[model samples]
Target: MATKPRMHLALDFSWTQVETDWRQPTSWVNRFYPDIGLFEDVARICERGLFDLIFFGDSTGIPNTWEGRIDAAVRRGVAWPRMDMSPWITAMSRVTSHVGFGLTYASTFMHPYYTARLLNALDHVTNGRIAFNVITSQRKADFQNYGYDELVEHGERYDRMEEFVDVCKKLWASVDPDAFVWDPVSGIVADPAKVRPINHVGRFFKVKGPLSVPPSPQGRPVLVQAGGSPRGVRASARFVDHVFGAGKGLALMAEQRVKLDEALRAEGRDPQQVGILWATKVIVAETEAEALRLKERLIADVPMEAVGAWLSHNTGFDMSTLPPRFSLRALNQRIVAANASPVGFVGLLAEQYGEDMEISRDEFFRHGLHAATGYASTKAGTPVQIADYLEEMFEATGSRGGFMLGHSQAGHRAVLQNITTMLVPALQRRGRMRTAYEGRTLRENLAAS
Candidate 1:
């Protein structure tokens, strides 16, 4: 029998776009920031498109890495003033049933007990429609916020993440599914014997007790991760059910998936059971010419300054100080040794090009400086063309998992509108994407996909 073809689509929800993009009429500006209605509207649209989830990528600090100053980020609104995703997600859940919310919470700072209690409550509130995007934060400022003088080393961070997740897992499993008795005649709310303390003790965390809240409908929220480093990959393989792949382009994504699959095998897991969603940008229109024109405009409008600030925040290395002619080795050494960036620049280069390939400083700068602004992996064209690319990429990458759609500018109003109205319908007509959700919960929907 032939294998079935399907795509798991998600939206990248963040505040950076509304803050950074100054030219257009941003969705947040018109709709107002921190408004529940805005999130509800987007969630409703995502439900209409049968999108699996709306992922909220977050950071803990106001980045000051660009030229060692926070003014640029403040001035440009580049990743500053991040609102907590919990409230909006809760509100969105009340308005939509099928769509899931992928909420990011860093394990580096939060304790396992708190995380367990919080997510458990959220899962119940969302009716089992939540996915946790686990992140081992690497930004130095984020560490400072948590009272650490410096960010921990990359490998060590992952080490802690493993323990942190282990503690959370133990806590989640502490309460049995059938623990709830609710027997009025016997006057029993739950079986005390069924609920017990996990009493976990590990390298990074030690938790002793059962979670305060019971398991939601899906048992536990789906585990989502976006780790790009080798250690990060291993951690994801051990814990994640869905991986938000960090690399761009077909080859990069394929390479990431292969690495993840290898890790899964090492951990005694079937690769097919773990979903890998590639991060990509798309611009669709009624006509091919219109899409091409829009793509050009969006690309042209991408400010190199904004790109530099964004890079600084991601890598934790200031990109503005690099001279026209600089050494790639020096840059990589600084990034790695200082633990300046969350995802090392060298790691990214290896993902794009082979690890063994020799890359000059000039080539690195050319690629790194403006890379964020350009939609090199963009699916831009008419709805049909966009759908064709989605199907082709889906097949090329082992015919499973799918893309998490992102837009270049902040707010991303146009991209969301076009995708909901045009591209999603096109994919549905081709039988590549779903018209209606397959299950009530996020995990079930993801499993079906």
Candidate 2:
């Protein structure tokens, strides 16, 4: 008999209950935002479930796009108060042996050498279980923090990103893996022949010389990128080992896979070797009713101001300036003109609801409520039911990649517990999930999948 098809699983703690869920009675984040123990517990649980990686998405600025002020975002805690999380990942690594960690950085603003060196060190600390998620920041708030007065042109941002990765890759390869030889007899630490200067001078950055660190396990960190637009897809194909896909719907997901495959082939890379981890939101319970009940809390008591703040920050267009009624096409054109992400929330909206369709402000907020809270895409059900949905999606989307399951209600510890203890066992019984970690490093385990 043919071996049963299996899928990889990752838990996304990027937002980490910063959504309205933090206000719920079941959430503990209100009392413990930076508590190391909180993340350590999560690490242990995920390891027990045999998760491949725990991902953290990041932004360096507070939301000030809504109504031209940061008060609303700060007051509601929407995408604000984010910690660096590198140290947190280090702390979690100490407790788990098999799981990997994915850390995000913005290529649009950060220097390539700094990022490359930092990830190399993290790979050493995690014993080779590290993945680098590089992004091109589109939010105005992020640009301001980087000393930019306005957003970079959409295509130019990707241009910079490509060059950024090129520089990083060159730096990573500067020092050969076998360079280190701690020969005490000769008082020699490394061979000069194996180390050389990269001397890279690109349009975005200039860096000189060999990285001042030993070669890390896996040689380099597994590279991950999330770019859903055509330009973004091309950039991802050029370098990314895997993709962080937006889970809009089955059809869109399949279409994205095909586009990525085409782009990969254009770059002379095989599509089969690279996977797309769809960003999925799920709420699992013993019964469907219980899961649905928890899902309802996502929209509970969330004011319009908070929704506006989130939408504006992500799309880089102030929702407060939206006309009483407008078409998605018009709004998207405006956002693109402003040099924001052309394929963010507005792009998703156009794909879902026709671009020419006009929507009233109130109706838009209703949709925004679901989008901002992640309720529109969240799947809630029992372990068996959720697994079935996942199985269908995994197969429909070419069965190459897997799901990066993000928590719908961030602070609901019980929800995460159910995923590891209940849902993972269900998938394991069906031979759809890994029963044991098969590789020492993250790249190897992803290859095993």
Question: Quick one: best TM-score, which candidate?
Answer: 2
Residue-wise C-alpha lDDT for candidate 2, range 1-449, written one tens digit per residue? 77776889999889865868788888868667778888998889889989999999988899999998999999999897888888999999999999999999999999999999999999999999999999999889999998999999989999999999998899899999889899999999999999999988877787996899998998999999999999999999999999999998899999999999999999999999999999999999999999999999999999999999999998888999999999999988899889987686788888888999999999999999999888999999999999999999999999887989986844688898899988899999888899999999999999885
Estimate the overall C-alpha local distance difference test score of candidate 2: 0.91
- Indicate the worst ten consecutive residues by lDDT in candidate 2: 406-415
Once fitted onto the true fold, the runs of candidate 1 whose alpha carbons sit more than 4 angstroms away are: 1-3, 26-28, 299-303, 342-346, 349-369, 409-412
Q: What is the lDDT of residue 11 in candidate 2?
A: 93
TM-score of each: 0.93, 0.99
lDDT of model number 1: 0.77
Enumerate residue pairs that collide in model 1.
Answer: 17-410, 315-341
Q: In candidate 1, where is summed lDDT lowest over 10 consecutive residues?
A: 15-24
Query: How good is model 1 by TM-score?
Result: 0.93
